[model samples]
Each structure stands twice: as structure tokens, then as C-alpha cells.
Target: MSNHRQAKDPRLQKISSQLAAHGLILRGGFVFGDGEAALEPSEARPAKSVLLVGQAGAAPWPYFLGWREQQPRDLQNPLDTWSREVIDMVAAHFSAWTVYPSDKPYQPFQQWAMRAEGLKPSPLGILMHPEYGLWHAYRGALLFADEIPIPDIHDPIHLCDQCVGKPCLKSCPVDAYSGDGFAYQSCLAHVRGTDGEPCRAGGCLDRNACPYGTGYRYPADVQAFHMASYAGL
Candidate 1:
């Protein structure tokens, strides 16, 4: 599509509205570089731009839960399945290509998120948003054949740097999080033990200890769902 036609297209606005109804937001997008490996497996042509879509906080929990109740009870990775279904529907409406973080080829979602939103990782490895803290996530993205207008991003203050005492690093019982990096085995073991009940039922203690974006923190049930998923329960 021509730039002129893209400028006149109302798809972006419509897409935002439709996604919002399902508790998803267009996190922002970027023009793809030539020869980037972000095309449909069957197609030789690469999409020109990609719009990141995801949820910011517990906004999607209710919608996702409602959707999940209707699906087969034995389904694995229910959340990922629901996300793909929702995002795929929206992508189809606008004739855009759909990609997920869970796709076999493993799209570079983390790098794309940093580039698209000017975000940086906190000590805990979750990208710290100035406003959302650790409560948001990128579910999928929509790719378009033509370059479209994306919002101009300005670098925001990294919240982790400004935190007074860094309560997050100190909150974990096993000290799984630190300046050095995460101790995955330690965290997993702790979460599986009887003493890990608090973390297992309420989500990561380190993540919840963050002061920023408290209002957006996921609810206990939502947190439990994620913790169960993380624990392979």
C-alpha cells in the first residue's frame, strides 16, 4: 500500500478500539528493516511494519477467564491459546500478519518491546515501565504489508534507578533476585516448597514489592494463575 493510502487508513484506530474491547492495547509499533525474518512462513514478502499488542495489568484477566471457561478442560497453555485466538481475530479483520511470543521461531519480542517503547529491564529482568512497573505484558503483534504511522516515543526515566532502597531484591525469601541476576533454580525450588506458599499463591514477592504501578498490580487470583503456570502445576 502507498504511504498516501496508509495515511488515510482508519485501520489503526479501529484496531485499537476492537482490541480494547477484549482488554488488549496496541503497545506501539516499528517499521521493520529490510530482510528481517518477520514474514509468514509461506510468504516471500516481508511485512513492512508491526504493531505490538498486549495487556497492561489485570485488564485482560476477566476477558481471558471468560474465554477459558468455554474451552476444553484439558487444554494446556490456556492463556497463550486465548491470546492467539483473540489477536488472530483482530489481525484477520485488518488483513495483517499475526505473531506470538510462543511461536516456534521465537520472535524477538523483548528486543522489539525495548525498541518500540523505550523501556529497560529492571534488576528482576522484567522490563520496568515508568507507569506500569512489572504488571504489564506483550501478548502478540500484528504485522502490516505497508509502513504505518507509529507514535513517537520519548525516553522515560528508568524507575529502578530512582527507587530508594530497592525493596524488590530484598523481598524474595531465597534471594533469587539480585544485581548479579536471577537464580532460576533457587526461585523454582523455593516456590515449590511449603514455605513458598506466599509466593505461590500471590505471585512473585519481588515483583509485588515494587512500589511503582501498585494500582495496576494483578489481582490475587490472576497472580495465582500465573504462579501456577510458572510452577508447571
Candidate 2:
């Protein structure tokens, strides 16, 4: 596709509205460059007209549970269906496009979001949605061909600040989280040695203890997948 600039497109607004109706929230920003080059404009990639990111909530939890129990041959079939629906809606507005889901490997994302954009490294256990807590996961991202108005970036709500119980910090059996940061090695060793015994049985106590995300809880299997990957198992 030509990199020529185009006028602001009305279809972008319509697409965002449609996605919101489908329960997907949108965030927009341009991707940046790698490392120190990130601070310099010369290192930047061609600014895409606009980028769309979508987040889904606890609505998919029960489906995830059923799929895990059934162990379907195509594990991702259901998620793929959901992702495709969103992508199609975005394609209606943009000609050339790219879509990314959270289940994809994290390395590329780190490079793209941090190194490229010059964004600071995300906190060890920080989850995206404040209201949903860590229970929610990003479903997909869409890129467009024309600049679209983006919502203002809001300060992340630090639910931990107001939490009285502080269950997430105390719930980990291994005490993997310190008030300052995560005890990465301790958490990894515990998960690997025990085959994720405690976590697989009851999910990550830390994540489960978050009171804010009661409605956006992830399915047990989804939580397991994330824990297993974190443990490198």
C-alpha cells in the first residue's frame, strides 16, 4: 500500500462505534523505533493512519472453561472466531491492515511497544484494565489506512492503592511478590518444581484475589496458560 497521507476518514469513527457495540474498547497510538533510536524520529517506522486495540471481558470465561474441559482438537477455534469477527469489522474501514491477539508470543510485542514506541517497560505484573483488574486480556489490535481521532490516554487506576485487603500481595504461596516488585526466580522455581500444583488447582491466588475484577474474571484454563507460560513450563 502507498504510504501517501490521506484525509481523516469517517468510516474509522463508524468502525470504532461498531466495535464498542461489540464490547471492544479502543486505544490509538503510533508505533515507535528500537532502543535508543526510539527517542529519535529517524528510527521510527512509517506512521500508520491509526491503530485500534480491542479488549474483551469475562464474557468469554464460560466458553473458555467448556473448551478446556472438552479439549477440542483445534484449541483456538473459538477464540479465532471471536478475533476474526473483530478483524472483519476493522477491515470494513481500512484497506491494508494488521491484527494481533494477546495469545501471540510476547517478545515481539515488547520490542514493538517498548523499544519501538519508546514506552517505558511495563511493571512486572501490571494488567491493562483497571476495572477488570488482571482478569481481562487484550483480544486484538487493528491498524488502519487513515488517521482516526484517538481517545486521550488516561492515568491507570491503581486499585492496589485503595485495596484494604491487599489479598493479591499476600495470596502467593511462595511470596512471589514483594511490595517493591516481583520475586521472579522464586515464582519460577516453585511453578516448575511443583508442575504448577497450587496454581493449576486454584489459579494464581494473587490474580484471583483482586476484588475489582469480579465481573471480568478469566476462565481457569486461560489463567493456567498464562501461569504456565510465565513459569516457562
Candidate 3:
């Protein structure tokens, strides 16, 4: 594929459209340096652009829940399984190389998101979205040998800046979140104990406290599902 063909490629529009049905969308994309492209040595294609595809808020939870229900009961990591299947289908549709953040080699997704989307990190370490807050997630990416026409990204205005007081840091009952960082063990223990009832029944208070994207907050059931997973239940 050549740069001249990219602007006219019908597949580009199809890829974006079809993915929306599965609640996936192209988060961002960027041209890469030759050296950066070499990061995925397993893939033979010299990547022209790395496209960040992801889920925003609970957009994918419904589709994923439905997908998991049809699978065998013994299935573990149902969300991961469903996401990989969705991502694989889209990758094939566009003839792009597939990569997941959860892959063993761990693709440099943070770098990819930073470059592709011009995203900056929030207090919780999750990359904050101006519109989505911490309610979004990068499920996978598509690496293409030829550039794909994509919208230009602008520097984001981090919502954390406008926050008068960082509620996310103070909302956790156990102080699991702070400027210092998350207390992984403390958080897990608290969420598993009687005191964790609020978090378990709803979701992480710290995450939910973010003012930017409350309208995009995951449904209670979705949040509970994630909390269950977080508790390793």
C-alpha cells in the first residue's frame, strides 16, 4: 500500500464503521520511526503507522458480556478473549498486523497512545482523556505497512488541571490512591473486606470520583464485574 492510495482507501472507512458495531473505535494513530517500527520483530511488516484502537467508557461492555455468555462456562478472562476476537477480525478486515497490550512481550502501548493521541497521564496513572476521563481503555492496536489516513490529534487539556481538589485521590476509603501511588495490597484487602462493600457493589470510588466523565461512567453491573475481577474472584 502506498501513501497515494491511503486517502482513497475505502477499507479505511469500513474498518472504522464495522468496529463501531462491536463498540470499538480507532483512538488515534501516528507514523513511526524505523527504529520504533522494529520493536515488533515478530511482525515482518515495517510499520508505517501504529493505530491505537480502544474502548471508551462502557461502550464495549454490552457486546463483550454477550460474547462471553455464548462461550463455555469455564472460560477465564472473558473480556480479554472477546476483545482479542474483535480486534483480530478488524485487523483482518484492514490487513494490518495485530498487537495487544497484554501480549507477553508487552507492546509499548503507553508510548503509542502518547504519540498517537497526545494523551497525558492523570493522577491515577491511567492516561486521562479530555472527554472520557479514566473511562477509556486501549484493547489493542493495528500496525500497517502503509500509512492510513487518520484525523490529526491536538494537545489535550487534561481534566485533572481544572479539578479544584483531586477527588480521585481522596475518595478511596482505604487511601488506596494518592499522589504517592496505589496501595495494591491495601486496596485488594479493603475491597475484599466488609469495608469494601461500597466498592464491590458499585466500583472503585477513586475512579468514579473523577468529574470529567461521570456521564460516561460504566454501568453498575459493569463496574461490579470489573471489581469482581479486580478481587480475583
Candidate 4:
């Protein structure tokens, strides 16, 4: 894939290099000709293609963490700020627009990933990546007015289907991660209370329990950084 693009296309390489400098990578993407079915029409624009760009492992954390230190303590949503700036710069360079996962009238990034990256859901409902498992995330996307030849999407290797016992379903003490749905209230209560130290400091227990992509798990400090933000600390 890399060689094919490098030989015939300079555009992908431009994007690839820009993202890599910040320790981010293009996760997967789709050419949104008619707009993805899951995307709310009111929220989506008439874009010819969508590039589902994101981080694959711990590569982006150092960029985020180091950048955060230079921000004011009272600065809000620093991670989102970092993502928006990085993606906006790249998109602008290519004469495209940027969208974020946390944007209002949210874009259907999950569907885009499924169509572009061949990702499936894990028991925790996070997109189960064959390589990065639950630790990966979609930071943002780039939308272009012109279509590019996107990589084909193959059937996702549903790792959760092959597991003996779904550890993520059982790892949360409150059973907040059961198949029914996440118990958001219960989870928030726990993370805000005294016994929440484990989760509050190092990320969700259930997410960490996933057996696949152990090598790609976010480093301890990075985990702690996000956990602290999630807990509003």
C-alpha cells in the first residue's frame, strides 16, 4: 500500500508526512460520494471524500502532553484544542475542511471507520482494531471537495468474536460495560468518588483489560493524563 501510493501519488505522502511529524497517522477513511448512511445529513457537507485521520497507538500522546504543559492551567479541553489545530492546519494546507469527533451534530466517524478501516465493535462498544484494540481513537477528519482513490475496505477481523471469555464485559466492578450499554451515571459517580483512584489515575479498568493490542496500550502517564481529564481533575 505504501509503495503503491508513493510511486503514483504525492498527495497521500504529503498528508502522511505532516501527520507523522506530530506522531499521528491516518487511521482509515472513505470517499463520501453520497454521504455515509450513518452521517446526519443536516450535519454533513457536500464533500467528495472524507479522510478518517487519527492516532493508532501512543504516538500522539507525547505531542499532546508536551503541548499541554505550555497551556494555561485554566485552559479547557486542551486535547481537543490540540487535535483541532493539528487537523485544521493539515486540512487548510490541502484546501479542505476539518471535522472533529466531539463536534456538535457529531459526524458518524464510527461508520466511516467501519467502511474505511474495516473496524468492528468490541464488547466495550469501542471500535475494536485488529492492531490497536481499545487504545486507539479518532481525533479528527479531513473533508475534501475532490475525491481520491481510497483504499478498499475488507471485512473486519472481529477479534471479540474469537475470544474465549469477554474480559471487558466483566472487568468493570459495577458491570457498567455490559452489552446492554454503558452505565454512564454509575461510572461518573465512581470516578468522582474516593474509590475511583485506579480508574481516575490510569484510565478505565475495563478498557485496560482487553487482551489484544497489549503492545499498543497507552503509556502509563498518557493513560493517567486522559483519565484525569475525563474525571475533570
Per-residue lDDT for 149 in model 2? 43
* TM-score, prediction 1: 0.93
Instruction: Write model 2 residue lDDT over 78-179, tens digit each, in one string.
Output: 555656666665665655355565543432443333221233322335543555566544455555433454433445656666667777777788888876
Runs with alpha carbons beyond 4 Å of true place in candidate 4: 1-9, 35-45
Report the Cα lDDT for residue 224, model 1. 90
TM-scores for candidates 1 onward, in order: 0.93, 0.60, 0.91, 0.89
Show how many residue pairs clash in every candidate, following the order shown: 0, 2, 0, 0
Supply the global lDDT for candidate 1: 0.88
State the weakest 10-residue window (summed lDDT) of model 2. 33-42
What lDDT would each prediction earn against the true structure? 0.88, 0.55, 0.82, 0.79
Error of 3 at 80 (Å): 0.5
Model 2 TM-score relative to the real fold: 0.60
For lDDT, the strongest prediction is 1
Clashes by residue pair, model 3: none
Q: Please give, for residues 1-233, the per-residue lDDT of candidate 3 as tens digits.
A: 22232354566578789889999998877666545535443656577777788988899888887888899998888888898898888888777878888897887899889877888888888888888888898999888887666656679897788888998888988898776787999999999998888999999998898888877788999999999998986
Residue 93 C-alpha lDDT in model 4: 90
- Residue-wise C-alpha lDDT for candidate 1, range 150-187, written one tens digit per residue: 75678988999999899998899999987678899999
Higher-scoring candidate on TM-score, 2 or 4: 4
